[model samples]
Target: MGIKLLSIKNKFVAKCLLLTSTLALSGCDDWVVMSPFGDIAKQEAFLINASTVLMLVIVVPVLLMTVWFAWKYRASNKDATYEPGWHHSATLETVIWTTPLIIILVLSGLTYVATHRLDPYLPISRISEDKPLPDNVDTLVIEVVALDWKWLFIYPEYNIATVNEIAAPIDRPIQFKITSGSVMNSFYIPALAGQIYAMSGMETKMHAVINEKGVFDGFSANYSGHGFSQMHFKFHGVNDEGFDSWVSKVRSLDNQTLNHQGYLKLEEKTTGHPVTYFSTVGDNLYHDILNRCVDANTVCMDKQMHLDKHRAKNAVKHKE
Candidate 1:
């Protein structure tokens, strides 16, 4: 009988442990999947772990002491010490305050150094296990424009464009030049890199790389309009062969003309848009978009600057 009871207790403990481990690994969101981190991403994860542990070092002891004090000073415990004159202890005060202050100082120093060293716009230092980035590996340039409820990705190197789909070669550094067409938006790909803002009429840059081949979720972190929920894209990290195949497949499409009128029509609130390919785009189309002059005869930044100068000159003449 004793042996059977002991076996039951052991099985119960094992099941509890398994359940807790599973829940802890599941993570918060359903869309996020477990994937291996690259060099930079691993550093970010390490910082998070260090901060959490440092905070718990203070938090755990305080919580345990609170419970212990309550239990020891219970009304039923007649032997407990009760000294009304006992108030302040300089030694205890110094310890309680200085410990957290020191922790914060250490954390802040580490964060400051890491922030500048791992700035997303900075060039990557290491590629893999202690391997320096090779000079021959070309950095892929992707131009991203955030529209009302969709995303547009332009590959200038390949002279191709795709809507709601982004593909890149694994183990290659990617440079994203992002801007917004309408309002403010944030681009985030959790498993791959950090988040960066996309503002209208302004370009922001981010550098990231994917070491593993997989499909990751990318979404707009900022709420724009009514259709904000549908503004998402798929990030594909593929091998060289797969990337070549994708480019070829996109190039084979016949209807690749993206004229001014067609582009205007596409800037609407669209959900689940099929991947589009544009074989021929108008010259300086991206520059026009950046300057907010996609429409004909609209004043661009250069023209505005020229107008401001002319106004100042006229005022000077009038004063003279």
Candidate 2:
């Protein structure tokens, strides 16, 4: 009777899980991470899948053993062993310890390789698995700034900038130099690459290429503040000609220029921000922001650090 009740409870739990998974799958449009459009994301997805499978090898067996032990050692089971002196078995000890140790080693190796391979700071050299990044195509450099509830992208090559929307040519390598103007945030575009943290007065870098021509979601994955949820941007992967046209359109936005003063105004906290284009961005605007001297009255972090070092040296000389 006890065994029967346990079986019935297990069946109900299994049925509930199946139903939940079915419902979740029903609302899916695309498996953005699992089926990503870029080489970096695709490789990341592979690592994820491999890691999941490795975990399940240990998980499935442990789950099965748990149920087996529960049933085999049940109170009502007359066939169950009841030896008072039996505490440990060499075979059981070896199996339990060896299995997890092997899994850990395998997982550690996978993590080491994946960490270096998918490192955000490491520059990627290929577009896809077989296609190498061409020598003719110059790597597109996009300076990214995480604002209160929006994103700012500055294209130095074209002297153009945009807020909440960005474009790049498909199959061309793109490098991102990311920072935050307000608080710490994460730059994430699932179809392009993994999340890389963006922080104030510091810069992080990422390299990726988009193989498909489509608009993808880009956002801050970090819980920054009250307006964090509104920090979503559109990433456009277009053909070379389309990208040129998009740049031209941004350059055509009259009376839309992003300088130190304009950036200060744009950094204000807001929600549901619309896509904005800037005709021109001031030179070295991103570098100035990185050094933490966007405001005229503020001292740059670099200069401050240098001053501190000089003072320390003078103090040591005086002591001598």
On the 0 to 100 scale, the lDDT of residue 6 in model 1 is 100
Query: How accurate locally is residue 68 in candidate 1, as Cα lDDT from 0 to 100?
Result: 98
Best candidate (score: TM-score): 2
Report the C-alpha lDDT of model 2 over 1-320, residue by residue, as the tens digit.
99999999999999999999999997677779899998999999998999899989989998999999999999999999889998989999999899889988998999999898888888887889999877788889999999889999999999999999999999998899999998899999999999999999999999999999999999999999998988999999999999999999998987898999998888888888899999999877998889989899999899999999999999999999
Which stretches in model 1 have alpha-carbon errors above 4 Å?
A: 1-36, 306-320
Per residue, candidate 1 scores C-alpha lDDT tens digits across 1-320 of: 99999999999999999999989767755533233455566667777778889989899999999999999999999999999999999999999999999999989988998899779888777676566788899999998889988888888888778888999998888899998888999988876777899998889988888887888778999999888898888988899999999888878876786666677777877776776778656666676677788888788766788999999999999999
Scored by lDDT, model 1 comes in at: 0.83
Question: Considering summed lDDT, which 10 consecutive residues are worst modelled in model 2?
Answer: 26-35
Displacement of residue 204 (Cα, Å) in model 2 is: 1.2
Superposed on all Cα atoms, model 2 deviates from the true structure by an RMSD in Å of 2.8
